[model samples]
Target: MTLFVALAVLAAVVSFVCSIVVWKLGLRFKLYPQIRERDVHTRPTPRLGGIAIFIGILAAFGAAWLVSSLGPDRFSLLTIVFENPAQVLSILGAALMIVLLGVADDLWDLDWMTKLAGQFIAAGLVAWQGVSIVSLPIGGISVGSSWMSAVVTVFAIVLVMNAVNFIDGLDGLVAGVTLIANGVFFIYTYLLVQQTSPFNYFNLASLIAVVLVGALAGFLPINWHPAKMFMGDAGALLVGLLMATSAIAVTGQINPAAAGIEDLFAAFIPIILPFAVLVIPLLDFGLAVLRRLRAGKSPFSADRKHLHHRLLDMGHSHLHAVLIFYAWTAVVAVGCLLTYVLPVYLGTSARWALLFIGVGFVVCAVITLAPLGRRKRLTVAAEEAPAAELPGVDELAGVPETHGPVTAEAAPVESPEPPNGAR
Candidate 1:
């Protein structure tokens, strides 16, 4: 745990510094493209933050490799790396490929077919390097033939990548949401490792989660509302790829029968946690795809009808919409994590975890729907008001009603047009 903390800190510092450098270089070189009609932000912003994030992750992995080579035998994290150099290298290589593909798309606006081809190649590379899912935790069922395992793993990775990228419409939405989700996932993985390999208490999944948490923490200051830069497609896709990898590394490798986890629900946590953490992104992605297909358009076609867009249309402020995402992510991710934790540590029934989830859902529903209720009330009040008492259009538009001629300074400035998409 101490070593892991040190590595996370190292990654955070490196990513922070790199982000600053990238931001400056972007401005100096005029690397950002013009703002599109569908973009939420007013100004053109750089989208190369993913390159810095990837560098930070790479640095952490490199440091881990060095420590594994030089450190003493007792450091189990070192040993894990030493034992699986091929797998580690493959993950990094795949990440590099993804970053390059994303950077090109960010700069050139590549077609969907081109992007999909790259995604499949990267996913296939990782699966071929033995990151493929071998079995399910459910009743110790295996995933069947090697070919089947590879196909399933590749498909899963691609699905997660797109799902995550679909929600990149808002500033800091992906970074903050990933931070919260991965934080909970890190805890779950660490606890699972302690139960399964008590002596070591270290694994690939937890390492990936912690490193991601650090990278996002470092990048988020710049990616926040009124962002200096966006993570763009590159960062979003990279995050999704790593997240899917981490889930597979932990979930696929664990043998429920050997781990002595008898409870059926407990055994399923490995499968459930990833979905629980990614519920929002997955939901948005699914809806978008279905909507586009119904309209006879490409599933990957861009639009302003995303869930976040709906929140903006419902009258939620920019900051409020982002916070709502964070809140729901925390509620769902932590709720699922507790289901695994309470049973193992407190000998309590899983029903307690269910109760927590139920209460959390109710709270989140209220927060999410509150804007719509407020809007409805405002509309009703406006409709019922007497015509004479109601302010005229000029007054409502910030022009003061006066008998005297208004000065230029006192005249209402035309409000800037709202961006087509939600922030």
Candidate 2:
């Protein structure tokens, strides 16, 4: 745990410095593209933040290698990397590939098919190096064949990457949501390791999650509301790829029977938690695809009708919409985590966790729909209120009406432009 924390801190420091440097360089070089019609932000911003995130992750891995070489113990924090050097290298190589693909798309606006092909290639590369899902925790079901496992893994990675990228419509939405999701997942993976491998808790999944959490933490200061730069396609897809990798690394490695997880819900948590954390992104992705298909457009075509866009259209302030995403992500991810936590640590039933999830869902739903109620009330009030008499031309020409001078409170406040340009 101490070593993990150290690596995370290192990643965060490096990422923070890199983000500032990147933002400055981007601005100096005029690297950003013109604001598109579908964008939510008003100003043009750079989209090369992914390069910093990838560099930060690389630095952490390099530090891990250094520690493994010089530290007293051989298998201290590099257990996974030492034992499976090929796999670790493959994951990094795949990540680099993804970053390049994203950068190209960010700069050149690569076609959907070309980007899709690149995603599959990167996913396939990682799967080939043993990151593929070999089994499920439910009833200890294993993949029938290696080919099947690779196929499933590739598909899952692509799905998650696109799902995550699809929701990068709002500033800080992806970074903050991914940070919260990975933070919970890091805890879950850490606890699971304590139970499954008590003596050696250093594993690939937790390492990836922690590193990602740190990277996002460092990048988020600049990526927040009124962002200085966007993560672009590269950063979003890289997040999805790594997050999917972390989930796959741990989720399939555990066997319910071997791990002594007899409770049905507990057994399924390995499968459930990943999707639970990603519920919003997946939901948005699914809806977007369906919407485009129904409209006779490409599934990967860009649009302004995403869930975040609706929140803006529904009158949610920029910050409020981003926070709503953060809130729901925390509620769902933590709630699912609790189901596993209560049973393992407290020996309590999962009913408590289920209740928490139910209540959270209701609260989030109401908050999400609150704008509708406010709009309805305003509509009713407008209908019931008597119309005011129009002032004469003289009054409009700065002459005082018989009603007297207009008070500051009575003056109409001009609404500012909606913060909706970042993508």
Candidate 3:
């Protein structure tokens, strides 16, 4: 346990250093993006943040490999029956491949279909590794089926990839949120591993999550508000894929019932944890698709209609909007933790916690909707205003009467009657 934790910490440090190097490289290579209409930032920012994160993940893996090779008794236990470490390598490899795909898209503005194809292929590779959902459990009840697991896993991977991608709107938004999500996963999986028997490979999953969190933390300094660099599609997609893979690996390997909770729906619980952590993005994805379809537009078309965009429109600044999302993600993530820790008999606590979550959601909703509500009221008031009392363009124009000639203050107001005459 100590060795694993140390490796994770080392990986984070390496990842941070890698981020700094990458930032320098970006500046020297001139790999910067221009300000676009949809962009939230005002200045040109360098990219290639993905390189740093990738290096960090690789550095962590190298340590893991070295440990396995040196201490055959300790690390070799990892290889004895589960083949978990190798599976982690495969998953990481898929993430790296997707990162490359993202980099290509970032640099070249790759076509939407092309990007989608790349994402699907990346997901396929991970799915191919046989780290798929294999059953459905309702609370503590198991409805085991291999085919259902496969479908669910594929769907989850694809959803998570897009979810993280969709929410990568502001500087440090995706990176920060991802780090938090992964951190939660790491803690949960670690605890699970500690409580379970030796055969449990939960530790490896947590290790991956920890390494990812470290990499993102390292990159955050460069990617925060008034960012000097952006992670581009490469970083966003890579983060998403790793998160998705980690969730599956952790949940698939553990039985929730082992925690002494009698899950009436055991299979559903594993799936729910990841979903809760990612609720904001996944919900936003559904909204995006529905909105695009309603507008008679391509579902894949990019636009400023995301949840963050709506928040910005409602008067939150970029950082505020990002933080708003961070708060919500934290809330949901903590809720997940509590659900896991507290047994079913303490159902009342979970219910009250959920009620609080609902209130939080309502506050966000009101903030989002209140401005439009005010606008509507203002419009209605304007229509009902007495025209005689309301100042008109002619009345406010400050033009002197022609018969009286120009007053010293007005000088006949020669500026085309101020067009429409309303002030």
Candidate 4:
């Protein structure tokens, strides 16, 4: 308990400080990006936010190690870092690979293939550390084939890394969603730690989950709407990789005796909950790929047809669109979290809680997306005058047009996806 609280605070503070430091560095180095056609923001903002996040993770882990080694007795909670060095090294190594790749992309705008090579290499490193899936649990059957499991595990990691990169379109979208998903995963994994048999090893998954939540929480304020900094591909991929690793750890490492046959739902929860936590982004990834491929374009192509883009086209402000996406993400992840979380400790009564929360989420969605009729902006003079006093359409036509956004289109229908994940 003491270790977890201390770790969370340390990680959050380090990440927050890193964001500020990186913001300063970005300005000095001119690492931010200018406004582009497919971009949502109107102003240039820093793009090296991921640098701080990566540094924060390292600082937090170092602090944890120092604390566990120096603290007299009560701080043994983090001793797992010292005891199981392999797990800690594996995750950090993989994370470093993605962070460096992000930095390269931010600086030089690496081609998609180059960045992808980095992703596969990173995923492979983690798999080499015995972090890959070894089996699939469904009903009473245990599907085990070493080669197939390894392939599946690495592919799952890479798929999520790309999915998260795709959904990093709006300000604070990926950060907020990552926070919610990691928070739920943290709670679920912590509960599993409590329920495991006496001989179960340390819960590295829970630690990774909490560290991710802390890092993302610190990043969110700076990355919020009307943002000062964008996380670019670096932060997006790092968080996504963290999420995938945490899921793999919990699902792959559970002992068979602990997940016995009696509880069918319990047995299935390990396999289902990880993916359920990321349902929205995964769904969007699939849809986006299909939409692009059908248009005779590469699956990596970009368009303004993303869900948030549609919301903006409907006249919702930038902040509103981001909030709507946040609400929808919370609805799915939190709802799934509750279903499993409530049932474990509360038994059948968990179903009622699930029903209530599920309905509440639906209500929130309906209200968020309620019919908001288009409202015309009224000038002060127009608001004060009657219909007879209003100017005619010809009077509006007489107003001279200034140099502004172009409505003219030519060549390709959709904007090509930016190489740096800037769009």
In candidate 3, clashing pairs total 16
lDDT of 2 by residue, 181-289 (tens): 9999999999988987787788889999999999889898888878888898999999999999999998754556654533557667767888889999999999999
Per-residue lDDT of 37-78 in model 1, one digit per residue for the tens? Answer: 667888778999998899888888887777877756656555
Q: Is candidate 2 or candidate 4 better by TM-score?
A: 2
Model 3 Cα lDDT, one tens digit per residue, 1-423: 566567667777887788777778877887765656676665556667887788888887777766666665666654432355556656777888888887877777788888888877777777677777554432333325766666667778878988888887777888888888888777777665665554645355676788888778878877787676777788878888888887776565444454343432322445676788889888888998899999998777788778877776665666677777787787777666655544443544455555666777777667556656765665666578897555344433333335544567755646431100000
Q: How do the predictions measure up, each by TM-score?
A: 0.93, 0.92, 0.79, 0.82
Better of 3 and 4 by TM-score: 4
True lDDT of residue 161, candidate 4: 92
> Model 2: how large is the Cα RMSD against the reference?
4.5
Q: Clashes per prediction?
A: 0, 7, 16, 0
lDDT string, candidate 4, 366-395, tens digits: 655553432233344456679977654433
User: What ordering of candidates by TM-score runs from best to worst?
Assistant: 1, 2, 4, 3
- Stretches > 4 Å off in candidate 2: 71-77, 257-262, 389-415
lDDT-superior candidate, 2 or 4: 2
State in Å the error of residue 357, model 2. Answer: 0.7
- What is candidate 3's CA lDDT for residue 287? 91
**Runs in model 4 lying further than 4 Å from the true structure:** 70-77, 139-143, 197-202, 252-263, 371-422
